[model samples]
Target: MSDPTSPIGWGIQLAKLWTSSGQTFPVRVKDIALEVTKARFPEPVGCVIPHGISGIDGMLSKRQKKKDWCISYDETVTVPGRINFTIAHELGHFLLHRQQRDTFQCGQLQMLEYDSPESRRIEAQANTFASYLLMPRNDFDAQVDGHELSFELLGHCAERYETSLTATALKWLEFTTEAAMLVVADHDEFICWTYCSQAARRIGAYKPPGEMLPAGVLEEIRSKALDARKFRRVAPGVWHPSEEAIESVIVSDQFEQMIFLVRFPFALSVDHEEEPESDAFSDLAEKIQGLR
Candidate 1:
């Protein structure tokens, strides 16, 4: 493995810590930070404060007087899931990047912004640390064992991990065998981000971050209201404007944010998708065309 402080490697350290102490799942991250910081470092984290941090989700710095390390966050972020993610993110900065600099301030989009490779890499490291610390790989896989994929299963996993639906879904996609995708958008119907599973990428499910919402959605969806369709099978181009893509998509309306969980038929589909011009799937096509 690489260095223990690397994004993937840090997970190994966290896993070791979790297992050595009775293998607690959905680990109590903040408490662990307080315990581990003092145990593992010369200058321990003095505080993890959920207080006013004007423009950022989380910030890491050193305090005055004794000048110990401290974490600051926007106390206004009400959702427990978001708050937890933010703090864990700062802990990531503390564990991974503190040696590189004295202070680290991060906005919600820092990791996802992708403005520069170096900046994105560090931010992504923080996110990975947070994800692995909260949801261990073995525990997550055990939860999904023998169960087929669905939006409801994702909801249950999100509840178990105490993270947001989108965060947990993204984490699930990171390790799931099932094909999946998550698209998040703001209240103005703007695309915040999009994720394609390793399986889905074969058929080219990738989309740029700022693409507009496509035309086939209902008015309520366009308005970004809350109305989720559990699992609706749709033809290609409903979400993506491609002819060779079809998906079983789940739309969850988290008020302004819309999450679409698109699952494809098989990982092997892309390998077999290159077929002759003849309609080998004509019967299937006729059934689908009838719906329109």
Candidate 2:
């Protein structure tokens, strides 16, 4: 095993572990894990149980000295995609964090959780691992390389990759060349979090924390409207405090709150000057997103 601490490295190694196929989708990861552990370690993973925990999304057994390991997850997680991510996350701990901690406990889908700093760090790594594993960049980029991101394009990718829209969108946002951002808000309209791509951030686009979602976006999600997936262009200082016009897309029917996927053309300067950074927005994006 390469044993790289970086999640992207670990994910690449895991994807190539199977000898018979190059395809990453529909990966029987549990089987590969069992085979690898049995071959590599004295204390190999032995069994996987779906009903071992309550309220918890997934967990790994306390480490033992002599070849005893088990993987377990909440049996009641009806969303197969979520369970798969949880399992992959546990496997990530097994590969990446096992030496640091004997057991791993994971919660249901969440973000920006207040926990010990160490635990939170590992959680982010595991999330990165899961995201990369489930949606390998090679295949994902093929589907989304030049296409403008809409819920439709992302929804199809989600079905193909067997992941939640949030996960899929996050993965795509990680590598997009387009100037785009994803902002999550709560039922009370408080901004939960936001993620902007390298291009978006470079163009000096930002949505600060604690700001309310635009009334246009709030009304779109609340309307029980199925046909609301087009560009909701906003002026410079609405949802985003930028000089450029932002094209926004509201993910509808999301119960209480909504998400806005905003995009705009990159900006240029005559003097080729770099925009000053927003310390507050930088801090906010560093926090985890997709919270619910």
Candidate 3:
């Protein structure tokens, strides 16, 4: 076994092990976590404590100058699927970034935005590692084949991976062959962030919702009905001429947010290109495509 020091290195090495051993993704994730925990600390004390502090999902604490460490999670987060993902994310940080810092605070956006270049690269790496560890590409790809990308389908994947709907959907977009986009909006006005699949980018499907939706647009028309599940499809000019259709689903809790799943015409091609290739990229691409 190679030294599991860096997050990326550990992830790649573990992914390879899982790929060859025929272990299931979720099972492998737990096994890796257990191995890492036991290797670092003495018996009984080395175990990862679940349902960490009141509000946080997971925690990692390292005493000064010690290689041995402790990891914990909030037990109140009873959703098994979400708990699994949080564990994987925290394990990622532990393996990859613990040497640099003693404590890590994880939240929804912070966990998923791992790919953002402007932010901490290690966080993104851990996220990538966790996603792959829990939802290996081979299994994910097998599920996605012949299935139309839908909220329900994404929800199912989330259940399978023990992650949130948003997380699973974002992962789906990362690897799906379909030209799809996931847009998250807040207050039905500002576009928080947008994620486009390889195919969607090629067709020029994007959103510059411009601080607010344009007057009389479907997003604006349905703004009040923010909690609705039925997505409204708009023609090309309404969203983007290059797209064959746009479907918007809004999820309003204490915060009103929208997720747009835009589907592009199968025949059209836009100039946008795929993400640059790297070791992490290869891992993710392979995981999503179920090649591993």
Candidate 4:
């Protein structure tokens, strides 16, 4: 059981209300933000509005004189998933961290923080709260049950939950039985962040955020106009020294980043044909070996 005073607990409690009322997918967080705050506190959320802010994705501000709260999100972000998540993130602050500070100004990175131990406690808590509030466990589980995990399948879950692909992928990682990792890299092919499932971690199939993506299929996809959606079987040393992995790629023009879904099999097949290592791949392998 989740702590009733915790962020996840509060989110679950609200989600239950929507579920019990026979409400459908994509929980209307904006409506609940205003209503819940008003019902619970005197200095409730006065408004949930959009602002033309440049750098800030969302801001939760308490009016100094009026003593009321307002949740404002960037209006220029056209993606419904990003906007909705930002709104929910602000709502998380309103519910969980309103008393911690007078205001919270969040950017893109803060919104993506989920369960990182090194992330700021309050920000991660708010993100967790927003994720649960937007996509509850029972509903999310039902959507992905019995399906082979892939970027295409996750895209459907994103659409169903009205969440960004990254958010949806992270949610799946939290509960998936497969050994998989979601890697976000910049247009330059430098890794920005990574989230691995427990199974992936157990097998040491993980990479840190700052490392450059090794020269391989993922790099080739970024450099050329290849099918970004197709999953390629990458050779050993590209991702792991002894184990080969399947790599799926997607380029997000909106965020100007590449998303890679890497899945590792439980055991390496001995009979699988091996590709001859190219000069670049060999050089990369040497570099990676030196680092290890």
Could you say which candidate leads in lDDT?
4
TM-score of every candidate: 0.78, 0.82, 0.75, 0.82
Question: In model 3, which regions exceed 4 Å deviation?
Answer: 3-9, 12-25, 28-31, 36-45, 63-67, 78-80, 108-119, 214-232, 246-250, 271-275, 278-292
Q: For model 1, where is the 10-residue window of minimal lDDT?
A: 283-292
lDDT of 1 by residue, 16-113 (tens): 68777885555666776778888878787888887686657788887756667888788786554776777777888888888788888877555444
Tens-digit lDDT string for candidate 3 (1-292): 5476655566566667766777654544556676755765352124467644675766666645454556677777754476676677777877767657777776544443434443346656766777777666678888888866678777777777677676677777777777777766676467665667777667666675444543446445555654334555666675566444757574645445656666764436655545674433223332221111
In model 2, which regions exceed 4 Å deviation? Answer: 1-3, 18-24, 63-66, 109-114, 216-228, 243-255, 269-292
Report lDDT per candidate.
Answer: 0.64, 0.67, 0.61, 0.73
Report lDDT (Cα) of residue 152, candidate 4: 84
Mark the regions of model 1 whose C-alpha exceeds 4 Å error after superposition.
1-3, 114-116, 186-192, 210-214, 218-229, 237-255, 271-292
Task: Evaluate residue 158 in candidate 4 and report its C-alpha lDDT on the 0 to 100 scale.
Answer: 81
Kindly list the per-residue Cα lDDT of model 4 for residues 232-264, writing each as its tens digit. 888888877767888888887867777889888
Using lDDT as the yardstick, the better of models 1 and 3 is: 1
> If both were scored by TM-score, which would come out higher, candidate 2 or candidate 3?
2
After superposing candidate 4 on the true structure, give the runs of residues whose Cα lies further than 4 Å from its correct spot.
1-3, 64-66, 109-119, 218-224, 268-292
| lDDT of candidate 1 at residue 291, scale 0 to 100 | 6
Pairs that collide in candidate 2 are 43-67
